[model samples]
Target: MADVEYEPGSEAASNILKDLQEKLQTDTELQERAQELILNIQDIRASVNAAKAGAGTHRRGGDEVQLIAVSKLKPASDILALHAAADGGQVHFGENYIQELWKKHAILPTTISWHFIGGLQTSSISKLARIRNLYAVHSIDSAKKAVTLNRLRPDGFPVVNVFVQVNTSGEDSKSGVEPEVDGGELWDVISTIRKECPKLNLVGLMTIGAIARSQAAKEGEENEDFVALVKVAEGLEGRIEREEGVKVELKLSMGMSDDFESAIGIGAGFVRVGSSIFGARPKKADASIL
Candidate 1:
């Protein structure tokens, strides 16, 4: 794929984003991303939708899998192009950094649901809680962070949906709860969030499988961590019901650009995909928290 030049600060790009943001309510802003990238996104979406349709297990409903465009590091113009894609493109986008996420969110229309898919710093929580259209946070690894988010959530704001990020791979370098038979510390963190944080809606679990585990898995077999996340979700179900007295819908958020298809096959309700759609990112400082 050839690189498409998109100057985010250029007047043309500014006009483009502004025009799209203004026309969001009307149906006039249906222009797709740049041809090559648009086609790429379309192709990826078709493949994912097919996998969702053919899923033999974990079939929940018509709305089974959500394809979250991991828009971090990509230019705003690139994001706008993909958002203008024909098939519900302006829905979900995931960002990894606090500063970058807020910058994009401010420019994009509220119709675009933003997912904070990175580590949440203690200081950043208050600011994030104030964003009116933040749809979900895919990496809540600590009970204290959950509590802070809950308390700082803007008054009258809807409950912010969150997922307990479990370190299913047991990698010391990762920033998530260690996965175990009963979720180990994962259970305690989520349970505390559920009981104490009324402003937060504990929705599901998320995990970034270890690279080695992904490579070691055979073609027919799912990654060990991916399979473990499913079991951890299952184990937490009964306990969640017993403790909360409410049947919460728990979804699994796993997989990335490399293993989303396999993750979807197993039962990933949400997949954070990037390069396959937008092309590779330039090497830069890591944006992920912790």
Candidate 2:
């Protein structure tokens, strides 16, 4: 695979597209799926905004909820097809594996904003940082990782946007800090990022709610896991201002395709949708269900 970066529509990109024409031609179905999903996300955002307007208080995340098309294991041709047809907002794609992200980042158009939304390995921090088009990292769990990521940011690029992952599900299998005000783990991590990591922007908080909670959310019930993450974001708001001496409006990244609608209703600023948009992957049983 070529590791050279290419501008959209550049000769190199055109050549790549030429080489992948067969794949792109077959991606019409993928494009339709993505477009439909985009429309659904927009409709949900609009409905949520309207509700917030009526309630006069529910608004918390940003004005819009961003969708990150999780493209792990999917071919780059599929991404380009989706990008060509994407409407309404930026073409932000999420990847779970560092190596896959690295390779795709090398080949994909620079216009596509790549977000790392999986577990972060200390050894791969350098490679992850080397990605010039990295829009954000949604798996930041510790102060140590934050410091290393910040230190290794490519020279002259803008600070990386990052979400402090909080294991709201309280699952030992998840990677995140405890979202407890009393325990101070959440505060400690965010405070560290705010004070210590100059190259990282403390953008928001993310969580992979328990599968049961996600299912429950679809049945018109609040996902306790998402509720916890929102609380964490809320708690951080006052503290970020009072202690950090900066007015930071932390957002929430707590939804997948399964429960993204409710998450948006609850003020989630970012939602990662994969299977719903791309169909199931090669390995459904994989533990990293980002």
Worst 10 residues of 1 by lDDT: 1-10
Residue ranges of candidate 2 with Cα displaced over 4 Å = 2-18, 21-57, 86-90, 182-184, 217-220, 284-290
Ten residues in sequence with the least summed lDDT for candidate 2: 1-10
TM-score of 2: 0.82
Error of 1 at 10 (Å): 19
For model 2, the local distance difference test gives: 0.77
What lDDT score is found at residue 143 in candidate 2? 83
lDDT of model 2, residue 69: 84
**Pairs of colliding residues, candidate 2:** none
lDDT of 1 by residue, 146-234 (tens): 98999999889778889999888878888898776465577778888878999888879999987677778887888988889888887
Instruction: Give candidate 1 regions above 4 Å deviation.
Output: 1-33, 57-63, 181-184, 285-290
Error of 1 at 9 (Å): 18
